[model samples]
Every structure is written in structure tokens, then in C-alpha cells.
Target: MKKIYFFLTLVFTGIQVQAQKDFQGMAVYESKTQAPKFEGMRANRDITPEMQKNMEERMKQMLEKTFILNFDKSSSIYKEEEKLDAPGQQGGMRIMMNSFMGGGGTFYKDVKAKTYTVDKEFMGKEFLVVDSLPKLNWKLEQETKQIGGYTCYKATAVKEASKTDFRNLRPKNNDDKKPEDKKEDPKKTSGETKTNFQDNFELPKEIVITAWYSPEIPINQGPENYWGLPGLILEVNDGRTTILCSKIVLNAKDKATIKAPTKGKVISQKDYDETVIKKMEEFREMNRGRDGGPVMIRR
Candidate 1:
């Protein structure tokens, strides 16, 4: 009986030691809102008719875009470890994004740059950029918080918003409101709803974003346009909707290869957004429907 109890204690200690080892992972980000003030827009139940009309007109000309970021777990190295692939790590990470008006999606490839050897100049660099304009930042803050079963940390970062062009959108006119046409089609008789999207004018104030990272699996990566947290960003709230990392996996048996996408030309993050908007406007114009150009979808 004494021998059995000792064996059990030894096994538990071994498990704890293994859990302390650094790990690699991939997390998916799901952003619910396009802009910071979207919630306020939703709450405005007392909007006036003219104000509503203008909002609707603007929505017709706006472009919608989404971005996803993938990270390379195999590119990471631990302080006390050598430079070699861990048990089940792989190549790199990829992010996928889509634009509504612009007819496209973007994939970020090879986010983990080539790992450096031990005792080299760039030894402790955490974040790496494999494609697109390079971005490098580190994971900091040592405190831990519970995220699922793994312990995560509170991490903060300031990243510039991707630059997208809001200029020269497809011009659209309010739909003709003839009484005869309205009476003829009961289903389409209702007036269009409007929304005042604040995408134009001055750039938004520098965003202060916060996220939770997990140290249980030591890879400093996350999904959809964010990385560099000490642990993976389990939840990110940037004064908008909260993007929680619903699930995370580390060192699974089958390793997934992370690679850069060669589909679109590599441009600066800002330029990329702008180009997508411009392309969307062009697409709208080219395929304007039978009702004379792009009909104002809202007001």
C-alpha cells in the first residue's frame, strides 16, 4: 500500500512538470462588429427620418472587408530548449479575410519568421512576420488567468488599423417613390432603412486593444490579424464586440503545415484595405443593375 501511494505521487509530479513545458497553438477570431460605434448605432431607436435616409444612402456605397491571421507554431523556441521541431509542431500560420463590396478575401501566410539558432543576435524575438509588410512585437506581463483549463495571462497591445480607402465610392441615387409603383408591390412598398456609417473623414483614434493569453501552451499566437500575446489571445475586446478564443489545441499528433498565400500582391496593410475598397466600387459600377447604376440599397 505504501509503495502504490508513492508511485501515484511520482506520476502526478511528472505530469505537472510536463505541463510546465512551453507549447504551440492556433486560435480563431470571430469579430461581430465592423466599427467601434456599431453598438450605439443599434441602440438609436429615435433616429429622425432624414437622418435615417442619409445613413441608408451611405451604406449602399460602402465596402465591407474581413481579415484573418494564421501563425507558425513550429517557428517558436523555448529558452531552455534547442532549435528543433517539437513532438508535433508544424510550419507556419495563415489568416483568411473577406470583403463584402470588394470581391475578395485575403490570407496571411507564414507569420512565423525563420527561427534563429541559440546564442544568436535575435534570440528572444517572439512575434514574426513571414508575408505582407513585416510586424514584430513581443509578449509581456507575467500574471495568469484561467481560460478553459489552461492558465492564460492578461496582455495588452496597440496595433495600427489596416488602411482602407473610403474615397470615390459608387455613386447611387435614392429610389423613385411613385405612388403607383408603391401601391402595386405591397412587399417592396416600405421605405429603406438608413445607417450613418462613420468610415469616412478623419482616421479613428489610436485603438487600445487588450487580450488574454495562455501560457499552458507557450506559443505566442492568435487568429485573424492579431499575434504577439505571451499566450494565445483567448479573448480580445477592442472597444467593440468581444472576440473570445473559443478553443485551442497544442502539439496534436497530426501537424498542420502553415504557409504564405501567393494569391494577392503583398502590399502595406493600409494600402491593402484601400485597394480592396477601390476594387469593390469598381465592381459595383461594372455590374450596376437595370435600375440605372447601383440603386441606393438603404434610403
Candidate 2:
């Protein structure tokens, strides 16, 4: 009985020690100085009905835009975490997304975020929490560098073009041109027609996201919209560079329990992508008939 009790005590002690070594420090992504360019995406259509519904319902829910992530770095398993929110425009509509990675590989959640404004001391700014999927398979690249006294690697990834079945954007009588069809379609006689709008951009193209992971941290996590690295990503860049862990304080005096937040609708990343496309198409079709905007239109 004495020997058995000693073994059980030793096992419990080992578990406690392992639990203490997970991810515990805050990984900071500081935005470096870059010249701002005034490029705009002109969309003739407005927000879709579905998107409008979501905006109306959940726009007021507070989100954590910028956060200080805390975790336990003692063990391979990360069971808890916390996100500390700051005050700013991009800070309020922020969300905590959870993804799982292991021998089974990484799986992401399909989450939708509404556009919102969080008042800041400087000025009122806007940010968007778009619903998207993990279309790219992320892996470590050969180029490596040291960050926060730990070795990190760069990874390249991309999201492929997805085809969606949405509300019909094509004209109803596209295939049929009989005499009866012509008579039935009065709008055809009027010159108003649905025009095919082409949005030209490359798809399934490579998107470069430079991430520096530290083996010292030992937890697979990152910032903004990325993860799946072997260690905590200290820095990540995709043209617009987001450098994380520019400053890290190890063995700080605070105990931050990092746990995934439970909120927002969780769906497969693919489903979320499809929903976004469907909404976009619906919005475009609804606006196609407008002339010089709705306010100016007589009818």
C-alpha cells in the first residue's frame, strides 16, 4: 500500500510539472512603418440580405480586436488560454478563433465577422471580420531566422478558388429564344438586361505569409488569421507585414490562463466560404437594376 501511494503521487506531480510549461508569455505583433496607398475596390452591389441580417443582429456583440495571448509552455497539450482586449477601432470587433492540429492535421472553423467601428482616442476607424476558410496548406519553408532567442521558420500558403452555387445571376431567358419566350419576356423588349460582370483576379495563386516560429515556445499558435506552425509564430508577414514577439517578457509575474473563447457560430471553413459567395452574388443581382442609385431613380 505504501509503494502504490508513492507511485500515484509521483505521477500526479509529473502531470503538474508538464502543465506548467506550455505557452505563458504574450506574443506581440507590432505593425512596422509602411507608406499607405489609396487603392479602392469598387463594388456596385451593397451588402447582401443575409449579411445585412447578421449585421443587424450581432453588430453590438463586443469582440476582442487586439489581444495579449497567454498560454502554458510546459506541455505539448494546450488546454487553456486567454485573450486580453485593448481599446481601439480594430480592437472591439475582434474574435478568438480556435483550430486543432496534430497527427490528424489542422482543421479551421468557418466563422463570420461583421464590419464595425470601435471608437479610439485618435479617430473612428473601421474593420471587417470576414468569414473565410483555410484554403491553403501551410508548411515550414527553408528560410529561417532567430526571434526572441528562439529559432523560427518561414511558411508559404494560399487559398484556392472555390466554386459556389448561388442565386442565379444569369438572365432567366438566356437559353430559350423561341417566339413564345420572347413574347413572355417583356423586359427583353425594354433594353434592360442582366450584364455579366467579370471580376478579374488570379485564383489558387500563391500567397506568401512569412512566419517565424520558436521551438522554445512549443505551442502551435499565431496571430490575426494564421496558425499551424510547430511553435508560436513570433512574426508573420503577407506583403503587409505583421511582426509578432518584437518584445517578449519571459517568466512574468502574472499567471495568464489561456482558454479558447466560446462564442460566434462555428462551421466548417468551406461552408463559410460558400455562404460569403452566395451573399455577394445576391447583393450584386439586387443592385443590377438600379439606375444612378436608388435615390435618383424616379420609380
Candidate 3:
């Protein structure tokens, strides 16, 4: 009787574990970013209140976006829910920004493998960026909150900020200075430097990202490049941007295809970053002029 009971317990435990591994779900996220607010504009010195309001409204419409995450126990696929482009955004610049900043591609994460793959489309070219996933040292906190009826615990991480992140983009303080007023650098070997890439591409060295995850889901996954949590991350605040979970469905019959992209020019993440930087510098040189006008649009 004792041996029979032991065998039955083992069978029941295996079934329970198998049930946990079979859990699959789909999560929808709402991501948004704030418009650039200059100090001069607030004082109405650089622009009128009416103009500022219109600018903000237009940018808000462009920045508000949505994403979807399909996940099982060990791997997940994240991608933006396709939407029509905003007016005046049907250009190379917008597409490049999206491709570079984790927007234009289908992102696939293999938690067990500790790797990620992104199928990015930039400026009419395709790239399959594959690299090890970012290892975030999540500092779990005692604080908890409710999101979409699930209790979520708080966690924070300090990670290196991307240089190409659109939030870092802003007009330089001396952008309106006259060409005559600017001094030339004698040490620059590339003859007369048309534009200074270093001065214009400033960004925070690091950013503190706060996340809220729910243990009820028991899945270590999140939207975009965010993961490595004890549970499913429902919300994330990265200073200038926020991605929040709006809805979730568990074990849906129509499971999303959670596979890594198989086509494109294969490149590591580091090489891709360097490629983007090089192209941006080249563009600046091409558009630079003697009139001291903007080589790149502020918006």
C-alpha cells in the first residue's frame, strides 16, 4: 500500500508541473512618452502659448503607441501593434528611429537561453540583431500596488541608457548662434568640421527604471526589452517614458507565433549601435551648412 501511494503521488506531481509549463498568455501594453518641454518655451520667450499647445498635442498623438507580448514558460515574442503613421512621419528619419530604439522590430526573448533577437527594418534595409539579453540587477522592494486587479510588487534597476533614445533628443542651447560667433577647432583633422556629433548626441549615462510585476502570473517576462523579473511585469517607468499593461489573457486558444525572426542581415547588438552612430554622423555632415541653420530637425 505504501509503495502504491508513493507512485500515485509522483504521477500527480508530474502532472502539476506539466500544467505550469503549459501556461501561455498574451499581454497588451500601452506605451507613451512626453513631449519636449523647454524652459524658454514655458516662459513664453521662445514661443507663444498657443504654438506650444499645438506642438504638444501633435507630438502626443505621435508618441502614444501600443505593444503586444506573447509568452510561455521560457520564451516570449514582443512587437508593436501596427498602426498608421502620424502625419509627416512617413520618412526615413522616423523609420530609423523606430528601428534603432526597439520599436520597428519583432523582439524575441529566450529567457532560458539568456538571449534575444530582433528583426529590425531601417531605411529600407533589414537586420536581424541577435545578442545576449541585458542582465538587469533588479532590486526587489517591499512596496506593492494594484494593476488591472492583480497585486504587483515593485522593483528598480539602474541600467545604461541608449545614446539613440529619442527622449535624449533636444535642441542645443547654442543652436541659434551665428556662424561667425562659433569658433573653429584647429585640432580637428577632417578639415573644417561642419557639425559636432558629440555635442549634439548627449544622453544620461544611466537611468533608473522602476517596474511593477505580479506574482500571480508567475512568468518572468515583460514588454519590449524588459524582463528578468520574478513575475510578469505589468508596468515600467523609465523617467521619460512609461509602459503599462492594459489587458491580459491566459491560455488563449489562438496562441501567437512565438518564434524568433529567421531573415535579415545578421549582426550583433554592438555592431548595430556603431552602424547607427556612423550613419548619423554622416548625415549631419551632409546637411551641415554655413548659415548656422539646423542640420537636423528638432522634432
Candidate 4:
């Protein structure tokens, strides 16, 4: 009897090891952002009822989005699912509006290497941004909850807001001329020269991020750049944005393709940010005297 029991124990251990080794799967997440209220316009009596309704609808469309994470033990690929335009919104106006409100690109993370890569498109040009993974000082708590049928533990961290988070306000410019060349142009005036509005516009310095992770999955991955946890993150709330996992497939028979995106100009994250800020300044310069255009004011 003892010998039989020992043999059975060994067999069960082997099975458990195999199960842990084959823990590759995919997770689907739905994210929602709280719509901003144009309080200034409302207080000044500049917002009409029809304009308010349109703003609400547009904000809803921009804030609600879906993403998929295809991950294994040490690496993952997170990308936004492509969404079709609304019916009857195939006109040039729709395209122009969408150009201002863009989504993030494919993000790849390698936990072992401590690196991340993002494929982003600004204006019409593509760029591949490579950078180190964000080092979040997460405070793991004893608090727990259930998400998507998995028991999750709570963790919180504080991080600086990323530049990509403000993509809507920083629309890209397609001009090929350099900044110095643009200044020397005879048609350009001092009043129309580029101004760094971002300097005056203060974004939140630190965002409080909350995440719920499931140890059952045993993978250090999550939607977007949130990672470095002992388990799979099932839900994340970063004040303005919330990402919740709707479904998780473990050891799926049909494995997902987890590959890095390879299309765009290769650049570091710092360089890309500088390029974007400069372009946004140029865009402001180009539209300095424009009247009747959309005005975006953040309070």
C-alpha cells in the first residue's frame, strides 16, 4: 500500500508540473474612460443642448475601447481591437474628427528582458518606440475580490502619466519643413510663430493605479504596460481609465500569435516624445488664426 501511494504521488506531481508549463493563453479586456464635462462652457452659457448631446456621444465613442492580451510566461502582446466607424459616418468630416481622437498601437512587453516596444502612428507616419518597462512600486494588499471567475488580490501603484495618454490634444502635423526653416519663411509672422502650449498645460503628475491580479494564471502580464505581478492582472483602475478582463482562456488549444510589431521608424521613447511635442507646437502655429475650428479646453 505504501509503495502504491508513493507512485501515485509522483504521477500527480508530474501532471501538475506539465500543467504549469503549458500555461499560455489570451485575455480580453474592456476599458472605459470617464467623459470630461465642459464645465467652463456650461457656466458661461456657451453650450447649447444640442451641442451638449453631440459632445456626450463623441466622448462616449472615444473613451470606450477594447483590447486583447496574448501572453505566455515571460512575454506578451497587447493591442487595441480595430473598431469600425458608426453607420453614415464615412464622410470626410468623420475622418477628420477621428484624426484628432486616435487610439494606442500594438504594445509588446518582455518581462525577462525588462523592455517594451510600441508601434504608434502619428499623423500618417508610423513609428516604433522602444523603451524599458516602467518600474512601478506596487503596494500589494491583503484585499481580494473575484473577477471573471478568478480570485484576485489587490495591488496599487503610483506612476507618472504617459505622453500617449494625451494623444487627442497633440494631433500630429504632416509638414516636412524643419522648425528653423519654418521660422525663416517670409510668410510667417512673429505672432504666428510656434508656441509650447504644453508648458502651460499641466497634466497630472502622478496617477494612482489599482489592479486586481489572479494567482491562478501565474503569468506576469496585464493589459497595456501594467505588469510585474506574481499573477495575471484581471482588472485595473487608474483614476481616469479602467480596464477589466471579461474573459480568460487558459491553455487554449489554438494558441494566439504573440509577436512584436515591425513596421515604422525605430526610435527611443524620449525621442518620440520630443518629436510629438515639437509637432504639436507646429500644429498650434499653423492654426493660430483659425476661427470656427473645434476648441478643446481641459479644466
Candidate 5:
């Protein structure tokens, strides 16, 4: 009886230690965005081959990024790894280009609590967008692949156009007019103007998202707004961009410090998106009548 009791106690203690070890870890993900060619924009511009190459490289540098996901069993904090610019390199057009691309943000997800928070910056202002985790109707597939030595299973879902994606669809302003600056015209009333903008600016209805998850790492966590899977997502491709796990360190000597972002204007995700659109419209209005202004590049 004493020998059996001792064995059971050892097994239970080992299970407890393993469970604790499974939840605390960090993952490194590399994101690559395959932006469409700017052939239409270059058609009218006097862009030399060298200049085109340089521009493309700069754009790639901006889009291709690395992120770290520090996670426990039920919560995770994902943040971009900052890249230092080359010495004396100016961010002239690249900065403007990034504003249109609209992505870099820190995301926090709590699966247990069904909550999420995003630390986003727009036009030099920080916004803490808090909201519930988006529920995805993922269709599990029989397909399997290995990512960073982990056997990952395939899952897919459809989601609405993200705020970054919506920014790309903003219609060009005919003329920058402040709401207070313009007098009411019979032919072009406020309602008509709004209708015209809505006609021109159509948001994408659905975005196909493909994710590969590993059951071995049994954590329902992923980068950005993706979650609710039965396992840890190792790779995700949402049409325009792909984020893949390059490295995962489990049970390290030092645990990653995962915390929700506290500083920024508190707002819901919907409100934050509206704020972005409003600011973008204001920028268009301010840049009205300016020659050689920022051109929208379709990707």
C-alpha cells in the first residue's frame, strides 16, 4: 500500500510541473507582405529602373517585419520588433507609404476572458482599442504541415476587411473642404456628397484567412486578431499578408513578461477605426489642391 501511494504522488507532481511548463513560453514570427506591383502608378511617373528598385526595396523593408508573441495558457501579448533605420537614411516616401499600408500595432489577447486589446498608432497619436476577441467560424481540414519543427493542422475562416485593409480603399477627395468651410449648395448637398463618397469607397466584404495550428502546443492563441483554435497557430495567411512562426522557445529559464498595454486613448475597435477614417479624410482635405501629392497605390 505504501509503495503504490508513493508512485501515485510522484505521477501527480510530475503532471503538475509539466502543465505549468506548457503554458509559459515565447514565439517569434516573421511576417512577409507580398504587395502588388505599382505598375499603374509608375506608368505616369519618371521612375528610372534604379529608383524603382530602391522604392520597392524600401517598401518591402517596411512590410516585411518580425514580431514576438509572449504567451501563457490563456493570454498572450504580441508586439513588433523595432528595426532601426540605416544611418542617414531618410523615410520620405516610405513614411507616407506606410500610412497607407496601416499595420504595425501591438495586440493583447485573453482567451479565457474572451477579451482583446490593441495598441495602435495613427497620425502620431496612440490609441488603445479594446474589444472582445473576434469569433471565427474556422473549418478544420485534414491538411498538415510542419512549421518550425511543429506539426501543424490546417484551419480556415472568412473575416471582414481589417482596418489596415480598409485604409487602402479610401476614395480620393475631389476637393478638401472642411465641414464648416463649405456653404450648402443646391446641386451638391451634404447628403449627396456623402453618397458619392460611399459609392466610390467600398469596403471588402470578406477576407479569407488560412491558419496552421499545432495541437502539441495546446494554446488557443495566435498573432493579431486571430484566435479560438484548439491549438497554437504556427502560421497564418490572410490574403495580403502571411505570418509564420520562425522560432518557438518553450520552458525557457526566463519567462516572457506578458502584460496588457495601459497607455493610450481608450476606445473600442469600431470607434478607433472610425477615428482613423476621419483623420484620413481630414488629411485629404488638407492636401487638396497640392500638386504632386501622395498617390494611392493599389495592392
Candidate 6:
């Protein structure tokens, strides 16, 4: 009860302070995902421990990333910070991660308008995905914590897992279930959702997101596709991954001007996802060897 009262007082003071200023803030975030483990492959003697270690290291380097969020009162732009790949080594893993995870380009959201426009680069083509901001039914919890010197409160929501993102993604291995799910799989002994070739595939129906937000910031903005909180979400844990704000510049001298992308074919998010799936299927066919394999399917 005391925490709630203090939080509300901060929010009121924040609104007053914000109203007097041209309020723009920049926040730096560290994002990381739990790379799916291949239990079946680990059990195989042919796959060495060294090979597994190397693979894990590669994924860690790719999945662990930095992002910047620039925001005002009711609008924000979230994007990955620029980083150089090793010389002559095109970031294949990073590129695939971007395309497969529906990441890349700027993610701009307008809270007042209830709209969001995002850019997606996939398979040598760019797409401008224009869609209404997803409405999340956020349930505010009384629990509070501190993040980067700011008091933060906990809130949770159950979102319909997006098919466009990596979380709900699973390769359709010529069947509704994964290779390990079928009895015909040579390596299958148990019904665990694990495959040797497909280390990253899980079909979760919903995404439960727990966010820690600070009301002192006083903005309905969050990292990535999450928003509509009473404050700026400083940390988000969506089961398989977590995004945490490391630093914040409330009002910097050189503010980033938020702008929507002008390039690429304008399409709704649904159509863009369908396009991605269709292109992926075609790509799979072209590269299909005698030892045929898996492709993505729509939810």
C-alpha cells in the first residue's frame, strides 16, 4: 500500500514535470534469448561436446544484442544499435535472426493514434508493415522493484503469440508435429519436443510477458512490440527471452528524430507474414536435397 501511494505520487509529479518540458528520452537495452537446446542431438555420440559448445557460443553472440529506444510522450522508435560484423564474414546468423524473428529496421509506435509502423528486411527485399498497435490486456501487479535507480512495478499480460516472431516459430517437418514427435524418426525414443537438425522449434500457443515499468517516466511505451503500460517498461521477460534497460537519458542534447521508413512495398502485417511464409517455402524447395527437410507453416 505504501509503495502504491509513492508510485502514484511519483507519476503525478512526473506528469507535471513532463507537461512543462518538450520531454524526449532515450533508453539503452540489453536483449537476450534462451537458445533452444537439442536434447536428441546431445544424446547422440556422433555430435561432439566441442561442436555443441561452438554452436552455443555462436548463438550467444548473435542472440545477445543491444537496442535503443527513443521516445516522447505518446510515441517511440525502437531499433537495434549498429554493430560491425567480422571482416569478410557477412552476419548470416544475424540476418537470418532478423528475417526469421520479424526484426530489422525501425519499430515506430504511436500510442495516441493507436498505430504502429515497422520495417522488415527479408530475402533481399524490404517490406513496410503498417498495422494498428496490438492491444494487450495488461494486469498491473502490486509488486515493485528497482531498475537503474528508478522504482519499477510489475505488470503481466497474456498475448496471442505472434507467428511472425521467433518465439512461436517451429519448422514444419513434413508433418504437423516435429520429427521427434513422429514414431518413424530413427532417433526418436521419447516424445520430447526435440530434434537433431531443428534445435530451435517450439509451438507455444500464447506468450506470457512480465514487464517491470517505472511510472516516473510516465509513458505507455515499452521495448519491442510491447506497450500500453502505465509507465516506461524498463525490463521485459517473455518466458524464453528477456530485455532489460541498462541506461536511460531522460532528455539528451542530441535527441534522435523518430521517422517512419519510406522505402519498401507497403503491406499489412498479415500479408507480409504470408509473403514471408510463401517465399520461405519456395526457397526450401529450391534448396531441397535428397535428404529432404522442414519449412515454416502458418498459424
Candidate lDDT values, in order:
0.42, 0.42, 0.78, 0.74, 0.75, 0.78
How do all models score by TM-score?
A: 0.46, 0.46, 0.79, 0.75, 0.78, 0.79
* TM-score for predicted model 3 compared with the true structure: 0.79
Tens digit per residue, CA lDDT, model 5, 29-94? 998887553332333257777877777777677778889999998789998787777765576554
TM-score of 2: 0.46
Which digits, one per residue and each the tens of the lDDT, describe model 3 over residues 196-237?
Answer: 433444566788999999999988999888899889999999
Clashing pairs in 4: none
| Model 2 per-residue lDDT tens digits across residues 1-299 | 99999999999999888756532565544543221221111223665666644543332232112234444442111121244543432432432111100001111222222111111111121112224334347776788788767787777665432343111112133344566554443333344322223222112223356677777766655654455567777876654334456566555777665433333444444554455556656766776555632211111
Model 6, span 118-222: residue lDDT tens: 888888888889999999889999999999999999999988776667744444445666768656645344454323233335557788989999999889999
- Write the candidate numbers in order of decreasing TM-score: 3, 6, 5, 4, 1, 2
Model 5: worst 10 consecutive residues (lDDT sum)? 190-199
Instruction: Point out the worst 10-residue segment of candidate 3 by lDDT.
Output: 290-299
lDDT of 1 at 238: 54
Selected candidate, larger TM-score, 2 vs 3? 3
Whole-model alpha-carbon lDDT for candidate 5:
0.75
Model 4, span 83-113: residue lDDT tens: 7877754444443333343346789999989
Q: Which stretches of candidate 2 lie over 4 Å from their true place?
A: 1-23, 31-67, 73-142, 148-151, 157-206, 239-243, 289-299
- Which whole-number lDDT from 0 to 100 does residue 180 have in model 2? 59
> What lDDT score is found at residue 1 in candidate 5?
100
lDDT score at residue 11, model 6, on the 0-100 scale: 100
In terms of lDDT, the poorest run of 10 residues in model 6 is 290-299
